[model samples]
Target chain A: MAKSIESLIPLSETAYYILLSLNVPRHGYGIIKYVEKLTGSRIKLGSGTVYTTLGKMSKVKVISVYQDRDRKTVYELTVEGSKLLELEINRIKIVYKDTLYQEGLFNEQK
Target chain B: MSKNKFRPFWSYDVLKTQDWLNDLSFKGYKLIKVNPVLRIFQFNKSESENKKHIINYDKGLDGYPIYIKDGNDYTEICYTKNFYFLEQISDEPNSVPSYNDLVSRNRKIKYIVGQMLLFQIMLYSFFILIVIIFTLGIGSVTVESIPSNEVEYTTIEIMSAIAFILVNFGYFIIQIWMIYSFFRLRVSNRKLEVFCGDGIDMSFTIPKDTILTKEEIRKLRKEKKLIKKTKVAWFYSPDKIEDWLEQMELKGFNLIRMSKIGNSFYFKTGLPRNVKYHVDFQTKKGANYFSLNKESGWKLYFTSYSRFMAISVWGQEYTELVPKYYSDHETKVKHAKKYMWTYLAVFLPAILFVVLSIGMSITLFAYANFENISTWMILSPLIMLVLVVELLFFCFKVIRYYSRVKATEL
Candidate 1:
């Protein structure tokens, strides 16, 4: 058996973005566009990258095929996927707080 | 005036050949038709425009419309068994970039290489088995080693033996060459850089001192001073493509096009200079992939079903150029796993065949000289030998591929 989800913490940026975009069911192309828009065009997902990521995510039960809408295939996050995204977001928030405090760039939050 | 011509090129020289096609387009000629297997291309006279022919290695035409929608005004021109040609005509002065991402491109490379390894193993095993069966059948009838009869070999038997040895020797050389070429390409390209791009259409400022005006390009073309030449090479040798292109540039022949399959390189006369060539594999290209590479100051020239080659032009003084796309260690390991799975899938059945062949040979030996069997009985041992050799060769290839992956991992 593969490692547990705990061991796979801190998902890659692309993987994290994909999970975040799957809050609503989105097709492969839709996920790409959504991620780009969310990141202000800073993260333009390549078609191959999205295809491969989707396959990997599906295999891990993190995401699944929502529907086969004509020419496009849509995917949505599973319960496990949403949980992972929540964990990752919290991890990022902690990291951000730690970095700012360590660098003495910010004071305590109100 | 319209003109047409037919030319044959090797299947591996697709990069230089695409460049040659673009050069022709620049000189008022456009590629119209190409036969993938025959490596033949047809070009017709046309007016010059800022057009680029993209030869990309991809599995199929799926999502092809995305390319058109990406805004290069792309049209599906033609395709070979593994690659498709997309022609992008832009009224703008420069070419639009490709749409493949670095990670996916790297993945595509590993996948294709793994699949090819599996195919070679399966093909060679079958071929060896057939050859062994035929040779043993013919060898048994020669009456050369029957215990009761005098051991005298016929002239035909001796000639057949020689032919068998020669054929195996030739096959061994070809296999070795394939491995060597692959390693050469891998090692030479090890220095390629992996960079993150902004994924936008932005041009780098070319050194103002080195810019060539349109007038100069036209003046040289009108002088009829341009020289063209073709060089053929083995399809697996992408390193050779780089070396030959560099050598030609040193001699003042600028690469113009690579034959559709990359078997031939077409060059035109130019000032002796330096150029760097790099290759990446991408089965499915994306618009952002091109935007990334173009943003990095690389030009996409040739693509086949599995790989694409790009070039960087600089003066002779420039060296130590970084590549735009390179597979990382994790990707290499993943590719290794893919190759291992394929090897196992084929090797399991191959082992069964070997066991069966050994059993058949034992049975044949038990019956040897005891039963009045036809000459066909003698073929058992030969077929077994061939099967054993095929398995060994397969193992060797698997090991080599694994080692390459491991080396990359390290």
Candidate 2:
């Protein structure tokens, strides 16, 4: 299961934002608004994209979705999902470090 | 003074009916009451300004609030069953009452069409049976069979037969009119879906160079150039049907169309390609359902008649990973269980009836003399027993499918 979780590491921008927004349980509409706000109104997700992505993530055990008291579908990331997100964040951090080193070398040569 | 008018099949197009009612209101006749069963519209003369009448149909609106303030724009005048009659209070054209959910309103239309289709089929079949019986009764009698003293009675019998035929003929004409209305309603419903921004643009134009004349098309059809084939099959479970459809597509049979009732599949022979199929069932579906699925590139293949407990078949050709509709384990299990329970609910009562009749027949056979019964009397229960066994087998398969779905909870 961990190895399979490793395979899910390069998540799409939409999926990553969706997972990030689901740190606290939120419905589809809430996730859309939260992601928009998080991205400073840059990444506005369509209901269709959010819906399909959530369905796929749920299928792969990355997230759990259920209906709340108002019968609105709410999504939350699972433990496996948290691990996947952590791995992705670490990969991004390493990429950022490598880019900083490359920029420093270019600056010295200039 | 009050005026009454019989407007049959007006509910087929609620918008048009609303417009007609508003027109009447403009002419001083305001709609007072409606007799849905008799298709009567009761109107009373009114000297007041023209009022906008809105006819709204929603099954969920039954027994709800009859009068809603709606920001003082419109108020519900009356409600019967699922139909709500509302009048615009502001008398402003733009301020007329409108449904917030057009998809559900259209769903009600689809439900009515489905029910009307079923009723039409049953009525036509029964009428045909009656006609056959009447013709047979008449054909079996000869002119000599009637005595001269009973000639008056024969005339009365012929007159009554004519009256029966005339009454049935009138009813059949009304049924035909209802069918026309249903067709129009369906067309309008498709337009509504597009209006709601949920319908996929399926309009494609034939290139000028590739256009064929009628004669050429007929010749091509005669030469079997069109490789379209239709196959008839029925399955109770969605999962089983989805797998079968996917397998068919894999085998180079690309499903192009489905029959109205959804039992027949029309496919065009093509190269084997990977395609994912999803059979979605929803008791109540909104426009969002279609728009969401359509946005993901799933082509709508077929949708069952009624929107209430409707089943839709969707497919998408994919080159890489197989697409999943209900990706989560819980949703997948729940869907399977829904199919199982629906089939069980429908077939259980039928199975019980067959079993009880068989039991009664067996008990009678054991007590009474067996020689008195005809061959058909004995054979009928045997056939029913076979049907009961087949239905039980089907129920078992559906239950097994549900359990299998539940077992994959990882």
Candidate 3:
């Protein structure tokens, strides 16, 4: 599982999920909520981490920053950012099926 | 109380000064008194007490230059050598004229005043020459005569304005160049290397560290031979400092404002023991200072013991592993981002006025300074008018700034 995680762009597991959540334009808090829902709260994006990552992402041009037509900074996935999200989604699909097939008779152990 | 006199870098660093003092003492240069940055010494081994070698150790802003006196003539040597032990107190009870006595005997202030007067004359002549060169040089290119017709005045006025700007442009640039040559510093990063006089090989920005560390404060106390002093840790760069701050909430670093010196921050630590990656820069001087802590500081100074210039551990010493090369290069280019603001801020337009004045004077001079009038007598009123206006403007600016300061304080 760790090997699978390492196969993608070098991002902390939390950053990948937050970037994954921002497939649509999202505000700062919205991204946090979306990451919590998507990762089942397994990855908590701290405020400092989120703000600093947003700054870094904007600097690298991975994400496009926009005003929400009302002055809040709205972040949307650029084509490059979208492609990275696609890779994560595909990896999760593989993991999802592998777990279901391998744990059918091992379910009572939990 | 013997006050010592010292020169610049040459007499100390290049001359192997401390050794020279020992040699001079062996040659009989008696030690008199010592100060922080100077040492005064003299010797009287004759039937009549006389001067042999007057060697001094000095540290000044432009780096130290030493003055040596041998009787009828004197030579000054300047270099970057540590020569603190150039003199030791003499044991003999003696009443001979000290070095201070000799300097008082040699005041050529008369010559200095003459030089200053000559300087004023040359400056005045140069200003007139520059203006004349511009006028005659440009005047030769203009139409032989202004059109006798009334309709041509507009074209003539337009041409005059353009010519005015061109002459002023050259004049102002030259003035700035002069000021820069006279006062712009050529300070090699002094703290980084004790310049060996052979070459300046290294440069680094050591924070003035003006807010002396606790260790530094204690050392200062020891120098003053005091019983105690206080210590504190205030950060310089809050962003880099945030990494070491205990709390998660980013609190800004505190700063103290000083009237004469400007703002400062202070910090202190024990003998740094943390092992981490660092940058090592060694210069011609045997001294090496590196950083491994917050600023990654470790000194391999010659004044220290045998371990001076030795590297303990700094980020797996790789050859030429400079951090952030691409961004650093980008910063090196003077992008002129604030060019217009700087031009206005430094009053470069005044350069235009100065050039205009000089060019006008020279042109008027070459044109016979209006023949009937005495050139200087006639020029004085106009020059005074210009000077008065300039002084009034500058005075207004200074007064306004002071008024703003007073208002803020109130």
Candidate 4:
């Protein structure tokens, strides 16, 4: 039960999906649909959760959001988001390379 | 008690009449049923309040012993899983405001659910309309068999019709749920005053002409006066209708409780161990005898719930028992999404089936005949990839709405 509250910290799944969804400048709803398509209908974000997360992410410089004359905040990943992606890729590579070496397949593959 | 003070309203939603043999106590009676959304309880009292001289009021620790706290002398009234409800009754003249506040919590929840239901209906109807419009063009798509040069009608019409019916059937289900919620909301609102200790009614429909004597009108006037309109704020059964009546009768004075046996209402009243029976004829509108409507006064109702007759009691000071088992929106949303793990069970299979279907459909139409078989064979995987992408896009749209489900408590 205590674990559930900790799991809902919002910056992980919501942030990742929103960042990926808005490869182009997209508004709140358009991001929702894009994420749905990307995930093959796996992740559905409630409207409240969506807006709240977007507001938080924007404040932290993870994603940049601006109004496109129509006054709807169209959101897109920023340089900071790319930095996050690089960090994630490096960590994954370390883990994957370590596993590959431990399994002794690196000798043949390399 | 201050009529406007917000108090703790305990609610535990358990199935009807099933034994909740957890740690619980009853000084006055054993609880029968509790509806959190309605904010009411049904219980069976072994003794009546009128005859019992020593009516001990306790700020008793729930799931423990009930005692009369007179200078710290705590007496255990009874040891059982009988429900004791904690509800504030307004000592003030006006009680609506306090009562409304309590009832409003439920009202807000009910309203949100109703809005969501209406949204679902609109969406279902929109899908059904699409299916119908597509069906209109289905008949025009005729097929000619290239091999035999024979005619064959496309099955698009049949598929369209089936899809239309399925959408309507889904809408029908939502309609039933909407109706049930509507009636439940109405009942909960109407019954608020009874458990609040003031028979509250802001508007009264007193008849202009009466066939009965002046005495009858006076009685109603008395009842109307009992109906306190001044809002002392804070808002907010089953049964063995007879056994409870007999017990109430033994204690003296007549006892009345409200029960619903279908669409209509039934009033079960008892006169001091004398006799117990149904008294629907004595009721007005759907109101039970005096206060025997859903939140009727000082009464217990036994209902056949789950498997046994669940008993519910309403009495003075503590009017209703709402057991909070701690399920909320988050719980439900969590529960729905928790099955995401279960998606693993079908995820691989569904993907494989889709991939296989694409592969077969592509292979079956090599060159659209046979002369250009090699050319079409080379194009097959590309066509399959395009089809798969379209299918995935459609699937994703539907799945996204259902994904990220919020947890709900039961």
Clashes of each: 30, 1, 22, 52
For candidate 4, what is the DockQ? 0.01
Which candidate number maximizes DockQ? Answer: 1
> What is candidate 3's CA lDDT for residue A106?
87
lDDT of 3 by residue, B125-156 (tens): 99999888988988743446656774545888
lDDT of 4 by residue, B298-403 (tens): 2223221211111223222121342111113443343233333234334446666768977786757863666756765656767767766754554453244235
What TM-score does each of the candidates earn?
A: 0.36, 0.50, 0.24, 0.21
lDDT of each: 0.55, 0.68, 0.39, 0.41
Lowest-sum lDDT 10-residue window in model 2 chain B: B200-209
Q: What lDDT score goes with residue A44 in model 1?
A: 66
Question: What CAPRI grade goes to candidate 3?
Answer: incorrect
Every model's DockQ, to 2 decimals? 0.06, 0.04, 0.01, 0.01
Query: For model 4, what TM-score does chain A reach?
Result: 0.67
**In terms of lDDT, which candidate is strongest?**
2
Q: What is the interface RMSD of each candidate, in Å?
A: 13.8, 13.4, 27.9, 22.9
Query: Where does candidate 1 chain B have its weakest 10-residue lDDT segment?
Result: B191-200
**Candidate 1 Cα misplacement greater than 4 A, ranges:** A1-10, A20-49, A66-70, A95-110, B1-328, B370-374
Worst lDDT window (10 residues) for model 3 chain B?
A: B95-104
